[model samples]
Target chain A: MAHVSIPSYWKTLPQRYCLIGMKCKNCGTINFPAREICISCKQKSEFEPKKLSGRGKIYSYTVIAAGSAPPEFSEQEKLAGSFPVAIVELEEGLRICAQITDYEEEDLKIEAEVEAVFRKIYEEDKVIRYGLKFRPVKKRKSLP
Target chain B: MTLQKVAIIGVGQTRFGNIIDKKAEELFAEAFLEAVNDVDKGIDISEIQEVYIGNSGVGGGQLGNFSSLMTDYVGLTGASALRIENACASSGFAMRAAILAVSSGVCDVALAGGEEKMNDTPRNRVRYWLGISGDMEWERLSGMTFAGVFALMAIRHMHEYGTKREHLAMVSVKNHKNGASNPKAHLQRETTLERALASPMIAYPLTLFDCCPISDGASAVIVCKADLAKKYTDTPVYVAGHGGSTDRLSVFQRDDVTSINSSVVAAKRAYKMASVKPEDIDVAEVHDCFTIAEIIAYEDLGFCPKGKGGKLLEEGQTEIGGKIPVNPSGGLKSKGHPVGATGTGQIYEIVNQLRGSVEKKNRQVSGAEIGLTHNTGGSGGTTVVHILKR
Candidate 1:
């Protein structure tokens, strides 16, 4: 895998942010990156962008051994030898595909709990890039 | 009831194999000529008033306009021609447009066709061509390819509906068996479920066998007013119903990859407008670009309840004798996918079923009077569903 690239905004954000979006006030549907027009209802609406809850269930996942790598992981061979990618069903109802950072590709199961965390994927120069890939959410000290 | 009707008086297709000798225009012209000639009762090319060409991979032309290059070769020039592209569903949408124009009384006769020549282009280039269909800003940026997208969908279906990995192999086994009976299919050899299951995986749960092959071919269908169909052929197929809707182009934007509601929306409209039920269709050629796609299609088209598609496979309901035969033309699976030409190609097969002219044997459903074609653009983002009747 190769050729995955990211923008400066996500790379340089002060806090780890999972890229998420909200539906327009005028239209009751959601969109990514927030747009003025609702794609479904076709209304020129505005969405209030919001950070994701960072937790979701694994909708689907795969262990892709082939295909081009994203630009951040130009050294993808080190990452690609074995990796997990999942289509996480965010609690908000939108399904998002992201890399699973904390597990082996074989460990993935359908509907497993998961959460997002910003990981410094690579550093080409002074810019240490980050991506909003996911990790299976372990139970946080239940009943504490 | 004077509901508008459109008849495909002519049809054509390039030989189903890789070719390097000619450009796309040459292929398009050749297929168009064959289609024009397929008009048995006799037709003149000059009478073709408009042209709608489907091509997703024709590149470097001064204009992205595909019809400009082929109308002259097909012996029809200066006719109002427009290109129709909806990814792999390009030709299907082209057929819908042609049907609409004739049914709307705008055109007496229309030439609808699609072609793609992609042998010489490297695999990576083909990947790039298809990559534009998904979310280029996010999914594509993450290096996800078409197979990757469908792979994701397959995984999601498994998670949500308990779709088994073996069920994916069932699709390949069925399509290959059907393909074995299709003379023009890219791979006309039957493969067992075990063989399909054991094939190398392109993406997890989806093997090389789970995917359709890249094809270099062209197809054409001539549409005319329904009343005029009797003048050309005794058994003219009617476009009983059609529905098309667009979903979010980006995979990430879709509510759920496995739950493609766009398909249900389009299919619902087509079924309602036609006053026909899914169970009434005798055969169907779904866009099985990947095996999982066909699974979702069964659910989306209302052939079965949502989440029951996998059980449909296990029960053999989609097989020829079980319930309603699906992808009997081998579908995009073994039939090969030429992107722009796939939609028309599926229609070609369905029409043959209605007309009783399928050259290959063993795969044909007995007495198939009604058929359906489902074509999509960029995952499930855009879908066009057509119901054809004899």
Candidate 2:
């Protein structure tokens, strides 16, 4: 794998580390991965940098099986037999795709509440890429 | 202003499979020659005014300027030539460009073709190369392969519409059954439902059989002004209407991942221009790059209601003798998707079926006067729909 230059990975650190997205002042739309323009109202409106709650539900999910895994993930796949990736719908009404980590295969399900956590996404060219991955939120038990 | 009408005078394609030894340019020239020969009255190579070649992988294959390379090999170097790259829909857009070139009077005759040699790369390397079309940073960097992207969509479809793995398997069984008679298909052997379902899973819901094979092939078509079409062929397939649309590159950004919006828009435009509704289409060749894609296409193209594509498949309505026979060429499933060549390859099947030239009569849709070809790039980034009629 080729080395991703410092600026390439560094610039997206905000979105990767904090789940920061642009909130449209005019239409109150939350654009994930932070776009300049809002898709909802088509207005060239001012934006507010909003830090997402990092809590969301699994909108969709897929577990990549062995033998057909992508080459880049070969290393990660070796550690975790099959990995699940999901599209998480954030509390702010914006959807973002992220790898579902820190959970077992049985724990993953559609609409399961999940919270973002910092995790190592991949290691390439001696540089370890870190990003947010969603894990199923633990259910609280009531005292009987 | 009204665009002048255009018609497909001739069409040809290489047998869809892994041509390990053949180069891209050679395959292109072979298909070009076949197209030129297929013209009923025969067309002079020099008279072809414009050339559009859809090539996506020739850069990896080492022949970068594939358009000029093919033009030179086919003895049409002087004719204006360019390459179109929209991933899998390259040739579909190339065909659109050629049709526009002829219809707009920019050129009386134009040649549209596509070629790709994907099998030359190692299997592991092929996965890396195929992933380039998607959002590399977010999707690929996160370790999602191409099939994984479709798997995401399939998962949503299943969650939303109750589309089962069995429904997906039925798609493969039907396509493979159709493919068995197609001599040029990559896997010409029919597979049973048991075999399709038992195939190992690549992604949770999509099994090995749900995806198309990486193939190496080429396809070419000769198009001319509709008014002058008769001079070349008595039974020319008219380019009744064509439409193309684009959507957000990343599937997550879209409002609905279950449906490809671009196809819905493109199909509406094509249907409007053709002055026909979806029911009028007697035959179709849809982009079945993945089984789920075919299901979504049925809904997007107005073949069935939204969330009901799975039911449509279960009813066997998409079969050869059913209501609207889709992917009569076995689609990209068994026909083999040679990325660049797939678009024009779809056109080749539609043209042959419309002309009553399909060698295997059983594969041909009887009394088929109208046909449609739906080609998509990436998941839903670009979609081009064409309506053709005899």
Candidate 3:
């Protein structure tokens, strides 16, 4: 498969890096990745651009075990050593899939609280590509 | 206009496995020749009016246009032919097209088939092409492979419905048992649940046994007008009803990952058109690319209520002699899934079961009058359902 060009990669920067989504004015349905039309109600209503809270619970998750990774993810798989990936439900009730990082193995359970953070996805042609990844939210400790 | 009724007169399939000697076209020729020979009264090469070949176009860059190349190789030259690509459900939609083509009075006889040669290519290339089925920019680019996509589904279904890993293993055990009886099956040996659970994990909760093998094979079916079907065979399988539906490409976008909406929509239309309820189906072949997929299919196809698929499998309901036997031809898991060829292969199995031609009596559903097949595209994006009556 051919790699996407710089222009194409830059086009979806809002969705790729920031947690931006489209909320339909007509039905209040949040469309992730910000689509032109609302999926629910089938109305060509005005879509309100909303920056998500980037907070959600893991709806489901999987660990990309070694030897079965795709060619593109070989580097990440090598560096991460079987990292956890998740499909998360945002505070707005919209679902998005992203890799989970900066977490221990025990935190990879279902419904684990996570928050989005921008990180390096990969690099090609001497250009470093970045994208959002979810990390387990830290539990608060009482001050002494 | 209402769809025309179609009947299947002949069906053929090559052994589903890694065949180093054959190419896609040769595999297709093998299945086509056998299908032509299977017709009760014998069908001439000239009788085939149109050909609908389903291929993921996995290697079309190297092999060129598959339909044209395959048709030319099989002496189908000058027959209006085109390739249909809907990821894994390619041939299932091709079956629907052939049914409509005959039902609408366009052609008297048509051939619907599919072929895939995934094994001959390098493993990396095969994986790359398989990833093409998902949203390339979002899913694949983000490091979510096909296995990872389904793993996510399995995780959610388990959480929401209390489905256990043992319930998932039961599907593999049952399918492999059925596939062991099928001589043409790729993996012709039954595996124990203990073995399945202990297999190497490809994706969490989905082990090697849970995934269908990558295979190279072909399948073909000869279908014609329902009324004229008797001219070709004494016991023809009528394609009573057909339906197709589509959903979002990526699984994350869908509200629910536990159930496939396309399968639900397609099954409803097929049931209504066939005038038979889910209980009426005596046998079925469903897309079980992954064990989790088969479990979800049981619910989506209405064999059991939502969230009850795991329990149904636990009760041994999907076994060969159980209520509404599924994937008797070993399914995509034990039988091989050559992507494009899978749907037609399912149709072939149903046609054989309905005609009482399956040599293995143990795997056969006795006195089966109504049968159904459900074929799905990548991650439930597209689904095609067909109902057949003996």
RMSD of each: 3.7, 1.5, 1.4
Candidate 3 TM-score over all chains jointly? 0.97
> What is the per-residue lDDT of model 1 for residues B1-390, given as tens digits with 9 covering 90 to 100?
254678888888876557788778887877787787778888877778878887886333424556777786666887889888788878888998998888888878998888887676776566566667666655654546677788888877887788987899999898888888877888888998888888876667788888888788889999899889888877678888899888877766676677676688889998987899999988999989999999999999989988999899999988867788898888889888888888888888888887777776567677888899999887877899999988
2 or 3, greater by DockQ: 3
Which ten contiguous residues of candidate 2 chain B have the minimum total lDDT? Answer: B57-66
Roughly what TM-score does model 2 have, to 2 decimal places? 0.97
* Model 2: how far residue B158 lies from native, Å: 1.4
Q: Identify the runs in model 3 with alpha carbons over 4 angstroms from their true place.
A: B1-3, B61-64
Estimate, for each residue in A1-144, the C-alpha lDDT of model 1 and write its tens digit: 223344534542422355657677776666655556776677887677666687888776666555433333446636566456677777877667677877754458877888888776556556655667788776568685
Q: Give the clash count for each candidate.
A: 11, 0, 1
| Per-residue lDDT of model 2, residues A8-85, tens digit only | 888889988988888899989987776677878878888898899999999988888877777777888888868888
Q: For candidate 2, what's the RMSD?
A: 1.5
- How do the residues B1-390 of candidate 3 rate in per-residue lDDT, one tens digit apiece? 765678999999999999889878899999999899889887788888989988887755434567799899999898889899899999999999888889988998999999988888888888778877877667776688888899999999999999989988999999999999999999999999999999999989899999999998999999998888888989899988889999889888887989899999999999999999999999999999999999999999999999999989877788888888999999999999999999999999999999999979998998999999999999989999999999
Report model 1's interface C-alpha RMSD after superposition on the true interface residues. 3.3
Question: In model 2, how large is the Cα lDDT of residue B36?
Answer: 91
Ranking by DockQ: 3, 2, 1
TM-score of 1: 0.89
Candidate 3: clashing pairs of residues? B4-B103
Give the TM-score of chain A, superposed on the true chain A, for all candidates in the order listed.
Answer: 0.72, 0.89, 0.91
Write out the backbone clash pairs for model 2: none
Candidate scoring better on TM-score of 1 and 3: 3
DockQ of predictions, in order shown: 0.40, 0.70, 0.76
